[model samples]
Target: MEQKKRKSSATIASIETEYVRSLQKKASRKHARKIRLYRRLTVFAVVAAIILVGMTQMYMKQKQVLEAKELEKMEKTAQLEEVQQEQEALNRQLIKLDDDDYIAKLARKDYFLSENNEIIFSIPENKKKTDKKDNGKE
Candidate 1:
């Protein structure tokens, strides 16, 4: 069996009215406002991120400086301790120098001085070992 097909053409037209135009205008304005709000939020987020990064970098730099200063302070404290010990030793030596008996003993030992008829005997001893032991005690 053979059948013929028929085609029907139909055209639709857009409705144009004052109320519809006003509604379209209001929708466009709302869309524009939304876009502007999004743009402003994006700019604000970028600026906030930049400020946060800058503050973080500054904090890191300050931390490094603080650590360096602390290290320097520790070194200076050690140096001060050494200087104080040296000063104490010097003060002790000054006190010994002011003593008459200590001064006479030191002079007699170093210069081989003898009393009125007292004979001085020079004994040979291991100077190196005695010097090391005396230095250790001091």
Candidate 2:
């Protein structure tokens, strides 16, 4: 009888030790899982930040390029308008040159030409007033 009682007590002690060991293992596994989860979250946050910064830089660069193109477009438009105005003035001069009367006047004034049996007279310009002003300034 005493032998049976001792055997039962020893068995209960072994079972209690096993239960305590299992509990310790469970706590350790939970702690390790928490650490792993924290590490994963940290890595995810870092990667997200890097991606955000990269996208922002790309957007800013593209915006700058677009602004430069817009400025170039404005400059080209202004130059085209100026060229068109110059072309209009040249067209007007071309029209004037096509007239016979204008051509005759231009030839007489610039080349000292005259028609047959026509008389031409020459007169000096009034340069004395301009000369006096220039002499005083100089």
Q: What is the TM-score of each candidate against the true structure?
A: 0.70, 0.62
Report the error of model 2 at residue 33, Å: 2.4
Tens digit per residue, CA lDDT, model 1, 25-109: 9999999999999999999999999999999999999999999999999999999999999999999999999999999888788
Worst 10 residues of 1 by lDDT: 1-10
In order of listing, the candidates' clash counts read 0, 0
Off by over 4 Å in 2: 1-20, 117-138
Cα displacement (Å) at residue 27, model 2: 3.2
Most lDDT-accurate candidate = 2
Q: Model 1 clash pairs?
A: none
What digit string (tens of lDDT, one per residue) describes model 2 on residues 1-138?
999998998888444688899998999999999999999999999999999999999999999999999999999999999999999999998999999999999999888899999888765456777878899998
